[model samples]
Target: MTQPDDIAPYDLAIIGGGVNGAGIARDAAGRGAKVLLLEARDLASGTSSASTKLVHGGLRYLEYYEFGLVREALGEREVLWRIAPHIVRPMRFVLPHDERQRPRWMLRAGLWLYDHIGGRRTLPGADGIRLDRHVAGEALEADYTHGFEYSDGWVDDARLVVLNAVDAHERGAVIRTHCRMTAARRENGLWHIEAGGEAFSARALVNAGGPGANDIDRLAGLVPARGLRRVRGSHIVVPRLFEHEYAYLLQQPDTRIVFAIPYEGDFTLIGTTDADHSGSLEDVHIDARETEYLLAAVNRSFRRDVTRNDIAWTYSGVRALVDDGSGRPEAATRGYELPLSDEADGAPVLSVYGGKITSYRHLAEEAVDALSKRLPALRGGPWTSKTALPGGDFAATEQPAFIAELNARYPFLSPADATRIARAYGTRAEWWLEGAKNWDDLGIDFGAGLTEAEIAYLQEAEWARSAEDVLWRRSKLGLHMSGAERDGVAAFMREGG
Candidate 1:
């Protein structure tokens, strides 16, 4: 078996390349610690990617009196938005209030608290809007007379994880993808970690395994004080169903809210049912019931009806939420918990609990603080707040100028490619598209703006290992490709293309 030889033991061994793990690794690496991030599968392949993709303070949690979590998440919103303006831009959500549901006064009160809680500056605060008077209310059912619009940010959740990994690597952290941390144990006051059928010694271990956080803890021979509920959330995509870029937050009969947002270039990404899940992690998938549920939810509020046949694609993932023992999945806390186990004469494992994609950066910072007691030698103050992620070194407020500048640099490039590259990669897109004087210079086209050069860049730089890694998680090109085109890309990858 392969092993890291003669090199100094890593300061921390992080299991799981999900948002929490990548965030912690980036935090640790930035703090001058030797870090190694190991992922059993692709980064954000679990709950991270399966999220509703909003970076906001949980407005609903305000009703539950989860003030601290909401405030922290709300506070960190601008921090994340500032770091990755291209990926994490402000999104306004229209919340159509139903008289049958919560009352108008109660909803107004909650929105007021949500607005004031986070020290919100750049994004507009929530406000009441009449359905008939507003442009966003055009698609809503005629009976829905009253609504509200609030500010939040939408993120490419998968790319958020990849960007964290990229930032970690740039900070001198070693990243191992497709490498599973199969086992971990304590040895000689340090951690003995195994990954990809190999072993290593680490001074500490961070179990940011998302749904598998508890499992990782058990493998490290520590008992968890809490267990995460594996709540499977599924999303169904259809051809663009709404006119506005603004997302809709609708209340269902079940008291759960569903989001219908414009996805990619020409599709509506509607999702997310919070069904309690207990199955093989690899077998997590969207079911016919979930499909019907989401379709019904969207169709209930919109003038257009979405049928099962309208589904362009479907994806599912399990959210590892800190089970407050609330049998109701919707009532489950969206806040993350860091539990440090006390064991005599061994290294401690910091197990991360429920966390959202929006608060991942703050979650990472908190996890690092949990590890501060052990390594007094480790310089630990605070860093990641104002720091930019891998490609987001731009003006925090706008990107039109950046896009215009990129077009000037590559006049021969199509507007679509140039715009996408500028938005997704920011200033770094130039490095990948270097020397490509024309469309043909980009090598093979994988359809939907994806090219051979992009694929190569993903594998070589972004830790993308499979076709799904590129198409679904890393980018949204899967929504535009035929099955045959996807199969060809997979075949080419397997053949070392």
Candidate 2:
């Protein structure tokens, strides 16, 4: 195995490429710390990409009396949108009043608290909307006469992770994808790390390993006070269920809620069932029961009766929640805990227990703050709150105008393709379209507006190596392409393109 050329000791070594780890790397790098991030797989190949894709305060958590977590996440919703407007856009969720579930008065109270708790300034407040009068009601059954509309944000989950990695790399952090930490030991007040057939050293180590957090801790020979409860959440994508721009939050008979959101221009993404999982994390998928459950949830709320045949795709992610000893998996806290171990004779290790995407930035801030005290070399205070991720320079309200400008600049591009590019890359789309005057300049077309120029850009800039990385994570073009087109992409990637 060839050794990595730069073996200099780093201020921080992060062991996961998921959202939390990437966020920390970006934060620490911006703080002038020499950082190194190693990932066993593609960024966000695990739980980060498989979220419900909403950046909101967990409304259901209000019942659990987790007001602090809800308030913190609610505050982050707008902050995240402001920082990454290209990927994080405001969304209105319509929750049809279910008499069998919570009472209308209680629901209204929760919404009121949700609006005021997070100092909401930009996003609209919650209000009751008559489904019959609202555009969202057109696709719903006639029985759903009334519902409540609340504000939240939607994110391209996988891209968010990659953007953090990109920003971290730009700020002088060494980000190595497909690099797994085989062993780590504290030697002479430093972390001696072995990963990807190479050896490295760092003053501090962070275990932001998501589902594999415990395994990472064991590799470092430290036993935590609390273990992780590996809970599997699954989602299904089907051909468009509703035509409206608004997403629906349907109440289940079992006191759970499922979201049916518009997805990929021509499909509806529905999901998220929480179940205790004890299987291999590598082999997670939506089982038959999960599929049936999701379909049933959609069938209960939508006028269209969707079956298994309508499912376009399915994906599952397992979250490593701090085992709070909750009887139900759904009741587990999405909040995170940072347990830092610093001994007199050993280096420091910070293990992130559990966290949600909405609160990742705050988690990183706190994690870095803790480590900064132990390592004096880490300069500067929290700066990520005011800084924008790469490609996210415009204000949140200017996205539509930005898209319009992109279309006008690239007249040869179709409106759909232009819009997709504008949303996916934001102002950075200009870089991909830099020298291209027409469609032919983009080189070979891979269907669904996936041009060779874009593929090359992803490979060169975003650390995308496989067809799956480009098609599924970087962009959801796989949903729009045929099997032959996908195979062509695979062939291109396999040829070292």
Candidate 3:
């Protein structure tokens, strides 16, 4: 392990723990670069975790005419699913065609381009569907006559970030959670970093601070040629808006669309309103207008009438979109830019701006490629595309069989519990379930299927420090856990369990 007291300078220091930062850390570490990753808070606590949790090509971007960005993201969809099948699963989206919103021909042309542009394979292509005959149609209002069905993938967004950090650590990267970089400066051709009251040195620094990218750049005494426009996206979870497994892509009177996805087996996840965010990054939540907007959009297509009372949970995140001077917040580009500054007498600093979760791996590959030109120590070519993340060695097609196998091995666990474990940890579940033949062997029950054994594993391996870190980020057990149960978890974590 790379100890804190070791004064040896690292080859790279990453400044955030979001998906991009974690991806970069993993890539850099795998390439044999001595790396240090610092997060101001827990991993994926910011924009990473707050995503709509879809790993798609941004179908809506096609309307914006972002062909290059769409192609890149579309190509990454299957690659990401291949490496992390446990977290990324194939999902089919139902787009109900409302003639008032967009012409049917336009939607058809866009879907055609989306299907063809990315060299798509493995996933089924887009096709028109009759609402009267499809299983997805059962949930919609009777008035809806036709729609489109397309393929995308869903991800455990927070877990993806954690897995990347785990992979990075296994490759000898120093993973520091809750370590905020207070200051950074160049001295003697090296970057001196002061984080969490400790001093460290690196040959290069990465400003992967998602929403704070510009702040980090300014802290490094440089201004980005382009600025970032912060946009807030909010989501609401309601008790199973539809019974079907298929997700909905509803069109609104405004050009923007809303998605209603089946979430956590018992809830429907609806979201994502784009509005100009103008507040402290720490305080992001759905306003009444956004909630109303989302509910209205859902009401337009579904037979169900949902209100605030039906909302089981709500979350919001701010995106650091590159300021392209677009008139609408939704019009901002989802592409990323890695601006590298190399001074004559100082080390280089690369700042990441405007990226989506779907393309994080590619962004990291490009970022490290840029850094390797300055530091010759970074070894190896792109390897992550072919590598399996931590526990994702099995084929995506074998998920059901793997879950059944897990249930057979641990007969004491219920089927749901077994499936959850298999999905979350994949083959890695054995690392914690080893030698445990029954429930008692897993230690004290913390409710919501969370056990002391699992908590210990998360703490020891995934850097989970609190109940929020475990329940909210590492897993979505918070949605299923009660207030008293959650408090017990908090108390247990506080008591050093």
lDDT of 2 by residue, 1-497 (tens): 32255766899999999999999999999999999999999999999989999898999999999999999999999899989999999999999997888899999999999999987998889999999999999888889988899999899999999999999999999999999999998887888889988888899999999989999888988786469999999999999977888998899999999999999899999978999999998878888888889999988888899998888888999998989989999999988999888566478999999999999999999999999999887898999877888889998899999988998998888889888998899989988898788999999999999999999999999999999999999999999999999999999999998
Q: Model 3, range 1-497, lDDT digits (tens) per residue?
A: 22265577999999999999999999999999999999999999999999999999999999889999999999999999999988999999999888788888988988999999997999999999999899999889997888899999999999999999999999999999899887888878888888887888899999999888888777777777569999999999999977888999998888998999999988999989999998988778999999999999888888889999999899999999999999999999988889888567479988899999999999999999999998877988899999999889999888889999999999999999998998899999999999999989999998989999999999999999999999989999999989999999999999999
Clashes of 3: 0
Model 2: which residue pairs collide?
none
Give a tens-digit lDDT track for model 1, residues 1-497: 33466767788889999889999999989888889899988888877787878888878787678899899999988998899977888889999989999899988888888899789998888889999988888888899889899998888888888999999999989998888877777877778888888887788888888888888878877787677898999999999987788898888898888899988868999978989888889768998899899999988999999899889988898999898888789789999888776766578778888988778888888888878777653586779998899779998776778888888888876677677777788878877788877768888987877888889999889988889888888987877889988998898788887
Give the range of the ten consecutive residues with the poorest summed lDDT in model 3: 1-10
Cα lDDT, model 1, residue 218: 83
Query: Each prediction's TM-score against the native?
Result: 0.97, 0.98, 0.98
CA lDDT of each prediction against the hidden true structure: 0.85, 0.92, 0.92
User: Which residue ranges in model 2 land beyond 4 Å of their true spot?
Assistant: 1-6
Residue 302, candidate 3: how far off, in angstroms?
0.8
